[model samples]
Target: MGRRHYILPDCQIRPGDPTDHLDWIAADIIRRKPDVIVCIGDFFDFPSLSSYSTPGGVEKEGARIKADLDAGHAGLERLMAPIHAERERLRTGHRKRWEPRLIYTFGNHEERIDRPAKEDARFQGVLGTHLCEVERFGFERYEFLVPVEVDGVWYSHYWQSSHSPRPIGGTVDNRLNKLGFSFVAGHEQGLRYTNRPLPNGKTLHGLVAGSCYLVTEGYRGPQASNEWRGVVVLNDVRDGNMAIPMSLDLQYLCREYAGEELQAYMDKRYPDKDWSHLA
Candidate 1:
C-alpha cells in the first residue's frame, strides 16, 4: 500500500534481451514517477541451472542456452540508468523531489542457481547467494520470490495459494480467483486483468504482467505471442487501494507514445506483424 507502485514483470534476461520495451520503460518511469518500482521475478535466466542444459553446450566458451553473468549486469545497468538520472534531476529540481524505492523479487528461474549448490558442495556458495549480481545498485532483494505488500496490495514473482485445499492452475485469473487479496505478478508471462466484488465494500483485482524479452527460444515459444511485452503502472494508491490512471500497461504506453526509434526496433523485429489485437 504505497502511493504508487510500478510493477515490472518477469524479464528472463539473457540473449536478445533489454527488449525494445526496456527503453520505453526507463523513459516511462521518468514521466510517471511512481513511489516504488517492483521488478516481479525471473530477472535472470541462469541457463547453467536449466534441467535441459547440455554439458557440451556449457563447455563451449559460448552456448545459446548459457547466460553470461556480466551481460546480465550490463542489461540491468542500461535499464536502471534512466531511473537514477531522473532521481538525481529531482533531488535538485526547482522544488519537488523524486526518489522511488527499487525492489526485485527472485523468481523460479533465478532459483536455478540452487541446484548446483545443492548437488556439489564445492560449488556451493561459490558465487554470491543471490540472483542479481548488481545488488550493489541500491535495490531491496526479496528471496524465494516472496511477495511484498504495499498499500494492502501484494506484489510477488507468482502467487502460490497454499491455503487452498488443492492446487489451482497457474494463471493470473486462477491466482486472483483463489486468493482473497489483490495482487500483481509476473512469471506466467501472460497478461490478464480481472476484478471481482467483495462483501466488505471493496474489490479485488489481479494483474499479470507481460515479459520484457525480445523473443522466445524453446518452451517459452509457441505461446510467446500471448505474452505481453511491457510494464504495468500502478498509481493513486491509498491504503493499498488504487486507481488506474495515466497508464495501466507499459506496452500500451509505448504503443501509444513511443518514439520513432523504438518503433523502428519493433518493426525490424516483427516486419510482417499487425498489432490490431493489442489495439
Candidate 2:
C-alpha cells in the first residue's frame, strides 16, 4: 500500500491586498495530492469580533461590528476562493477513491471570540452561525480535537493536558510516548522545534507541525530570532513503517511566488518598518 502524507499549513490570513502565495500553496497541494490537509489554526487573522447591546433596545454596536465582520469575511472569501475550489474538486474526485479528511483547530485568536460569548447563548449562537459560513466556504473543516487513524497511526490537533500533579508521563514528550502515536499541534507560531525519536528501544515518535504564515509585526521587531515561516509535511511510510519530515521553505516560496507584489503590499501597510530582509 502507498504511504499516507499529511500536510499541515498554518494560514493566519490577515486583511491585505490578497497575495498570490495563497493560490500557489493551494496549487502545490493539488499537485502533491496528499492524503489529508490539516490547517494548524488561525486561518483568519481577525475575522471574528465581539459586541454588546445597549439598554435602549438598539444593537448599534452589534450592527457595526457585524458589518466589519461581513467585510472581512468577503475579503477572505475572495482570497481563499481558489483554495476552496481545489478542495471541492478533491472532495468530489475522491468520493469513490478515498474519503480524506480536512481538519481545522481553533487557535488562541479564535478562542477569544468564544470566551465572551460563552455566557450568552444568543451571542454563542451568532458565533456558531458565522463559523458555519467559514466551514461552508471550505476555509476549515474539523474543530476541536479531531482524531484520525491513517495506516494505523492516530493524530490530534491538541495533545490532551495531563492530569497528574507530578505526572511521569505528563510532559509533552512523555505523553506522546505513552500514547504510542504521532501527535501534531500548532498553537505556537513558527518552526522552532520538532522531536522525532526512533521507536527502537525508545518509546514513540512525535512530530510538531510548524506555522506557515508570516510572523506578526510585533514578533518581527525586537523579539525577532529564528522566526522562520514554513509548514511541515509528514510522510506516513506504510511499506517501511516510518515517518519522514519535509519542511516547505515558505520564505523562498513567498518570495518566488509572491514576488514584488507582496513586498509592495507590506511596504504600503508598514511604511515605517523594513521587511527587505525577508526573502
Candidate 3:
C-alpha cells in the first residue's frame, strides 16, 4: 500500500511575520493524518545573521539573534500545537496515536546560523542547528542541501546544478530531464510540477513549490510575491510514484480553516502593505 505525504514548502519563519497560516497547516494535518510530513527547511529566517546588508548597517540594527530564534521556535510551536492536541485527544480516548514521520531538510536561510561559528572559533559551540531544537519536535533534521529519500521519493531544500553549487534553475520538465528521478524541492517561489515515464515502467516526478508563508520579501516586489503560497499533499506514493498530488493554496486554507478570506486577512493584519496581487 502507498503512503500519503504532506509537504510544507519554505516557511522562512522570522520575527514580525504573521504565523497564523502555520496553524491552518497543523489543523489540516490533523484532518489528513498523512503518514509522513516533510518540511523543505528555511523554517527560520535569521535576518540578524543575513549578509545582505553591510556590517553594522541600519538594516541590521536591532536584529537580535535571540529574536530570530525565538520567533522561529514560537512559530514551530504554533504549527505543532493542534497536532499535539489531537494526539492527546486520541490518547485520552484510547485510540492509536497519529505519529507521522517528520523530516526537515535545512535550507539556505537556516544555513546562515553556521556563518558566525564558521568565521570565528569563539562562536563555534554556541551557534548551530541544536539551538533551533527541531529534534525536540520529533523532526529528523538533515543538513542544508542534503537529499533524503522517503517512500521512494527524494527530497532536499533544492537540488544543485551539475556544474555549480547553486540550485538548479529551470522549469519542472527541465529539472526532470536533468535529475531524472522522483524529486521534490522548495526554494524558488511558486509551484511547478511535471512527470515523465521511465523505460523500466515507473514514473519520475519533479516538483518545486517554495513560498508557504504570509510574509513578503520586499525584493520580490508585488508581482513576484503574488505567486501561490501553499502546501502540497501527495497520495498513493510508493516506489517513486505519486498517483495524486493536491495543492492547497493559502487562500483556500484560510477560508477552509479560519473562516476568513485570505485577502481580507492580509489586509486586516497588514493594513499598510499592498497585496495587489490578490486582486
Task: Please list the C-alpha lDDT of all candidates, in the order they appear.
Answer: 0.67, 0.53, 0.89
Candidate 3 lowest-lDDT run of ten:
270-279
Question: Which has the better lDDT: candidate 2, or candidate 3?
Answer: 3
Per-candidate TM-scores read 0.81, 0.67, 0.95
Please report the candidate that would top lDDT against the real structure. 3
Lowest summed-lDDT stretch of 10 residues in model 2? 50-59
**Candidate 3 lDDT for residue 35:** 96
**True-structure lDDT of candidate 3:** 0.89
After superposition, candidate 3 runs with Cα above 4 Å error: none
- What stretches of model 2 exceed 4 Å from their correct place? 4-6, 17-19, 47-80, 83-100, 129-132, 138-140, 164-175, 192-203, 215-220, 237-242, 255-273, 276-279
Query: Model 3: per-residue lDDT, tens digit, 1-279?
Result: 999999999998878888889989998999999999999988899989898977798878889999999999998899987887898899999998888999999999899998888999999989987788898787999999889999889999999998999988868899888887899999988999988997888999998988898877877786676788999999999999998579999899999998999888888878997656654
What lDDT tens digits, residue by residue, belong to model 1 across residues 178-203?
A: 78788877777556677766788787
List pairs with backbone clashes in candidate 2: none
For 1-279, candidate 2 gives per-residue lDDT tens digits of 556565554555544423345555655665566676666655555433423334334433233334444544664455456655666676788753433456556554444456556878777666542552556555445554455555544555555545642222324566565665655566554553334456474324455554555445443465563455666666764522445567676565555555644446567666775656443
Residue 120, candidate 2: how far off, in angstroms?
2.5
